[model samples]
Target: MSSRPRRPAASSSGVHLLSSTRVITALVSAAQLGEDDLVIDFGAGPGTITAPLARTGSRVLAVERDARFVADLRRRFDDRPRVRVVHDDLRTVRLPRRAFAVVASIPFAVTTPLLRRLLTPGASGFSRAELVVEWGLAKRLTAARPRDLESAWWSCRFVLTVRRRVPAECFTPAPRVDAAHLAVRRRSEVDRRTSSILWAVLSAAYARPSAPARVSLQGVAPRRITHRLLGGLPAAEVPAAVWLALAQTLAADRNVIPPRGMP
Candidate 1:
């Protein structure tokens, strides 16, 4: 975990300043936060976003994976009763069934898993809350990264608005790529069919060693490969479970060669 003071000057302007105090204030104000909501700031580095969210009179679970950063956050918000610092892996960390919103300075790699955990079913899943995260990997889902893009798109529909081209120079060790803000409100339930389709696509793609090449063949490769590999497997109009079974079977067979899905 890295530590840096809130740059009062740099915090006031620029697109890269999404996590800055000023930007967070604006975001929260725009959100019209409910007073009782629990706002979880995932990957809270130095409590920049945490501080303002706490001011909303909402309890804030400031989750930071870094030991050093968690210590710093505790010391910073020691007096604020509303702030609770959780030092653990945000990915697997479980919380009580308390309703809350989530504000994240997300790590690009784990974004999908985190979103699924929040929106999917069961006790470990989050019920309802406003969410803010990066828009990376938000494009249409493919067989290769089905769950990845599926989760991103599922959350995207609830997005009332987005702030794009946020500058990258706002952090101490600034990231190379620009970031965007996705202001999301959780949906009641995710579409099971859509999620199923996405999983089928991705599971099949990743199973193949030449996944990148196979996925680039566009929509034709899955059908063509299914046919050639499964003795002319018919169109996938059947139940998703049946298609999933077929996809799993084909994906696990290394002997089945696939056409180039990408150039």
Candidate 2:
């Protein structure tokens, strides 16, 4: 996005800072920004990572909602054409159109929502994200190899990784719990719209995990894949790849026969 003259949006006082310089170095090093890369410093409070990001030769868009922080950022990078300070709420603002990397210590409350926006499948222009967020969420994002139902769907979209643990003291008003840096790598695109829809089925199944997989999948899985011929297979009994590759597609096939046996 082009650099525009911005006015302060609001006064800044209460904001979290990724205070340690070592962490900043780690984040930037991991981002491995290129000269042509467009990087977003989301919730760029007082431009903590902005200066270093600019020095990396990549164009930086520092978005801070607070007017005071915006003013501070502009003043700090007054002569640096590479850094454009934007005064807008991170949630409502439109991100850049070009492929980009994000390295930010954003508002912890908006962590999931922000991720939902940038990491949604078909969400173009995002190559990767290295964000400092709540520890529990970071763990969940990278927990399983295929992770959860959400990650399974995202597996078609991006790679998720949990980096170093960040101490709670890294902020002004320190959080009660610890934090961590989570990285997301974009996956190569393919025709996975049907597979993507299967994620909703998986999410519903997992929502009541204690229920037998057969019972959980009953409403979502097609009868051809669930009948007596297929037997009484529990949800846990079936591999997700089967759901992605067979169930739906097989349901559409006219020549296929439903199983005749029961579990």
Candidate 3:
């Protein structure tokens, strides 16, 4: 219940209080958290979702990048022991090595990077954590569009549930298009290390086979490797050890085609 209006909803930019609070409520209910759980609310604008999340008796960390919003939150919930307001950008902020749930209101920008870091290897990914995020499904990404999300295929187990229509009037500065909520959870146990390892191996395979070349500053960046780019893997990069591990990972789905021919 912090009554603060932040941005506009895509449906109609009428400046209503951030109604996206409901999305947070849905996420909490779905997670069925316990007292020992830690719930993170990234991009917490003015503690709307943060305050409610704290009521669940779980330790809540509300992360906001804006300085003004941070000061306001500190003043609003200073006495709440269950809540801690962090004034830092989530992209660079080092999240706790463990948490029960991670949720966000889905700012239009940075969704891809957020997913990449959360799904990436090491301690950064949401190991054994439930993740809930909201996104705009109405916008279609074309190569002509500045940013293309077509290459990003959601995990098979992930599910998208559309909520009530959110009007543009919901925010201060309305976005150009309408938005929808996407609730995503990994149905199976996934090894974060394996995911990262696959990313590295598959990316190297997709690069065009050209060699005996000097170290070029214009070399392809490490992040370009995606599921779409896995088909054209280089033969030299496919070692036995890496392939064996990949085979085990892909064995669960027999239809999977290895980036490299089976040795």
lDDT of 2 by residue, 7-102 (tens): 223324545677777777788889999998999999987666887788899999999887877887888888888888899988888987778899
- Over the stretch 114-223, how does candidate 1's per-residue lDDT look in tens digits? 76666544233243443344445433221222333233234322333455444556443555665555555544432333334434454344445234424432463355
TM-score of each: 0.58, 0.74, 0.60
Candidate 2: residue pairs that collide: 9-67, 10-67, 213-235, 229-259, 229-260, 229-261, 232-263
After superposing candidate 3, which stretches have Cα over 4 Å from the reference?
Answer: 1-17, 122-167, 192-263
Please give the lDDT score for candidate 3: 0.49
Candidate 1 structure, TM-score to reference: 0.58
Residues 21-89, model 3: lDDT tens digits: 455566567666678988887777766667667778888888888787789888877887888899888
For candidate 2, give the lDDT.
0.69
Q: Model 1 misses residue 123 by how many Å?
A: 7.6
- How many clashes does the backbone of model 2 have? 7
Per-candidate Cα lDDT values, in order, are 0.53, 0.69, 0.49
Name the lDDT value of residue 162 in candidate 1.
59
